[model samples]
Target: MDLQQRINAFVQLGTFLREISSESISKTSSSKFHNQIPQILQAAQNNNRWFTETNIKFAFASWGHALTETTINSWLSSYSITQKIPNTIAIIMAGNIPLVGFHDFLSVLMSGNKVLAKLSSNDNILLPFLVSFLVEQHSDFKESIQLTEKKVTNFDAVIATGSDNTARYFEYYFGKYPHIIRKNRNSVAVLTGKETEEQLLSLSDDIFQYFGLGCRNVSKLFIPKEYDFHPFFEAMFNKKEYINNHKYINNYDYNKAVYLMSNIKLLDNEFLLLKQDSGYSSPISVVFYETYEDLSELQTKFSEDKDRIQAIVGNSGIAGEIPFGKAQQPTLWDYADGVDTMKFLVEL
Candidate 1:
């Protein structure tokens, strides 16, 4: 199939998957879908068919809209597919959040490159299943993608994501090729105390999605010392339904203990903790904080750690927009760890 046809197929798949209820989506557990992900990854690797319908649908819906043909055409028109696309790309996926490697997958495919996906062990199921489903729908896609569990070689370009520690390793190992290596990032929110109840409530999603495991999940809150955290706490407590999971409770207990033992002062309200620290990105139940006298001061402080800050919440004068609950639901333009994958793919 031609590139446009492939893009159409992806959009169709996205629509189909989006129609499936959240309950249905959740029911298709990674375990049940594990075997299929390899096929999906294979399709993506083989035909330069990057996007699956499920991913497109999620992306569109995540952005609170439908993917239009115009949008697809516009995106495709930006690239010159007259030349043969790159044959292969090696992608070392990250498991920090569900479907986090999708943008890279889409970029490689759309730019007409075969993918060699080093699937993250933590998320071995979803991408493969989605790819398999697309391949089943379109035979041509089957030739384009491949999923391999083994170490890969001889790729024109590489994209890998990992913690700050592993980024160095990826850079050293893959630096010879055109690569984008991601390091740790933590999202934070700046609370001005003047926030409306609705705004504070909305911020809760930024704090708690995926139990705050995703890099985009806020692990820090910037608030003035006198800021009354009760309203924020009350808003989050109302959504205590989210904390029902055992994993979150365990993080809460562990972090809570560390705080107690260290004698770190905290402001607690039933389900979450607010503590002071210079760092960004904490565990599920805890958030680090720093009081700022003004936005200028906050900006200066943030500038010093720009590499570690992913998404900033609150009323800060920053460039990037913030999305709620879908901390992992990046748009087509959302570059991972702020690196441009599309540009990287196109360059190759």
Candidate 2:
């Protein structure tokens, strides 16, 4: 009903997620939600093979850490948030990783607005189930959230996320409305050949987490010229278990085959492929590398192509560069595309 009530409900949801994440849901906890965890997890994996239990749980764990009362208050404190008439905001979600569109959903409701969400089929299970948990926390939330299969209309504004092609469609259809339309963007890492083994191993998480599907996943690397691949490959060895996922292995094999057939020189570690490329987006099991002459030049390049890049990960001193391994662990205010979702909603 009110902002505090909404925040309280989400705090409850966060506690539930933390319990599930830690495998410590007490017997006296909300039995219905707790009992449904296994089914929800199974359905998520069944619906999208990319939604492995480990990754889904990690997503939950990340959100659990994020939705604390202190953090939520701190994030929202910057906005005025005084809307007398709530707008119905439609959200087009992306299922690349678990709950990828949740920030928008959270923003709408927290800003005293209704949500009309079109959940990506690949991620349909988790958010709706969590919505059920939230509604139970406060019945008022039921009227605030709507999940739909038909064309989304009767909304005051739109926030859509999709590939570059779908973005064109979104632009054609929803461009007239107050909107934020996002397209394909990738994250990259800068390796100065000075990172410690621990840092490199952590950086592997930035690369391989969610099998490199999320926009935040580091799909490219900027290494100094003549930087040996041996240490980098060795650090990545810690994530060799990713090869065990059949879907991931299939991509690795198929991409490797295609590259080999094309006569492209590749550095292979049996599980992952390293290729010299000038591009940012790489195949699922491959990471693109480019040699950098100077960090200042790379920063200038990133500045010029800011829209195409989501995050720059490293200690290269690039402005807003995320440290290694923390790309996926974005804070509540870490807007995707660097556009403030809360400001957009509040302004509406």
Top candidate when judged by TM-score against the true structure:
2
Give residue 231's lDDT in candidate 2 (0 to 100): 90
Error of 1 at 119 (Å): 0.8
**Top candidate (lDDT):** 2
CA lDDT of 15 in candidate 2?
88
Please, what is the TM-score per model? 0.84, 0.98
Candidate 2, 1-348: lDDT as tens digits: 889998899899888889888765633467888888888999999999999999999999999999999999999999988747889999999899999999999999999999999989889999999999998899988899999856898999999999999999999999999999999999999999889888899899999999999999999999999998889999999998988899999999999999999999999999999999998899999999999898889889999989989988998787888888899999999999999999999998
Alpha carbon lDDT of each predicted model: 0.70, 0.92
- True-structure lDDT of candidate 2: 0.92
Listed per model in order, the count of residue pairs whose N, CA or C atoms clash below 3 Å is 18, 0
On residues 280-336, what C-alpha lDDT tens digit does candidate 1 reach at each position?
767669888888787777777778888888877765554454644445555566565
Q: Residue 149 of model 2: what lDDT?
A: 59
Worst 10 residues of 1 by lDDT: 45-54
* Backbone clash total, candidate 2: 0
lDDT of 2 at 279: 89
